[model samples]
Target: MQPASIDKQINNYLPQVTVNQKKAVLTVVKTFAEQDENEYSEEFKKELDSRYDEYINGGKLVSEQQAKKRIKKIINGKSK
Candidate 1:
């Protein structure tokens, strides 16, 4: 069956389902979504690791006061 047909069928039957059944369906959907969320590409992982290494090595480091000033300048549209 097509997705639209399945969706229409689900919508038609949802109102007839018990509250516990609805909660079960919601839990199943959240599990599927969380599985997708945990999958990431190797290249993305490498990039994240590289940024973390730079942070740990103090590369491109800025003081808290300097960071706040830069943020304020950017928010005020005065960043160069």
Candidate 2:
């Protein structure tokens, strides 16, 4: 098998719990570290950066009205 597939299998086999019911946070960290980093495309990166910038700089939250409007647009098939 390929290295990535092998590593994923190994990661999946790791123990998920310990003695005191503490969550396996290290497993999440390790999985993130071992993840295929290049799966994100340039466009996806640009969109992620834009959303992160908006959240950090504008501190914007999605309003119910905006969500309703988006839903309406989606239901009408008007959103591309």
Candidate 3:
């Protein structure tokens, strides 16, 4: 199908929703509160540890509340 035609059909299914409902839905969609311990491979763990070190040293670590606000801003199509 043509891109424009597909976009039009998708838009039909997604009517403009209220900001509150949109925020709630986006929160549920993006938030994964649990992790599977066995799913992490050694290489993935190494990469994650490296990035964690950089984030800590760069002073870019955020609290849970700050992280939520940043995520909400992203989902709402707004800048952080």
Clashes of each: 0, 0, 0
> Cα RMSDs of all predictions?
4.2, 8.8, 14.6
Off by over 4 Å in 3: 1-37, 55-58, 78-80
Candidate 1: 10-residue stretch with minimal lDDT: 71-80
lDDT of 1 by residue, 1-80 (tens): 99999999999999999999999999999999999999888899999999999999888988999999999989889644
lDDT of 2 by residue, 1-80 (tens): 89999889756765565633334556675678777563787899999999999899987688999999988989889645
Which pairs clash inside model 3?
Answer: none
Q: Best lDDT goes to which candidate?
A: 1
The best candidate in terms of TM-score:
1
Query: What shift in Å separates residue 16 of candidate 1 from its native position after superposition?
Result: 4.5
* Candidate 3, lDDT over the whole model: 0.76
Off by over 4 Å in 2: 1-38, 77-80
Alpha-carbon RMSD, candidate 2: 8.8
**Residue 41 of model 2: what lDDT?**
78
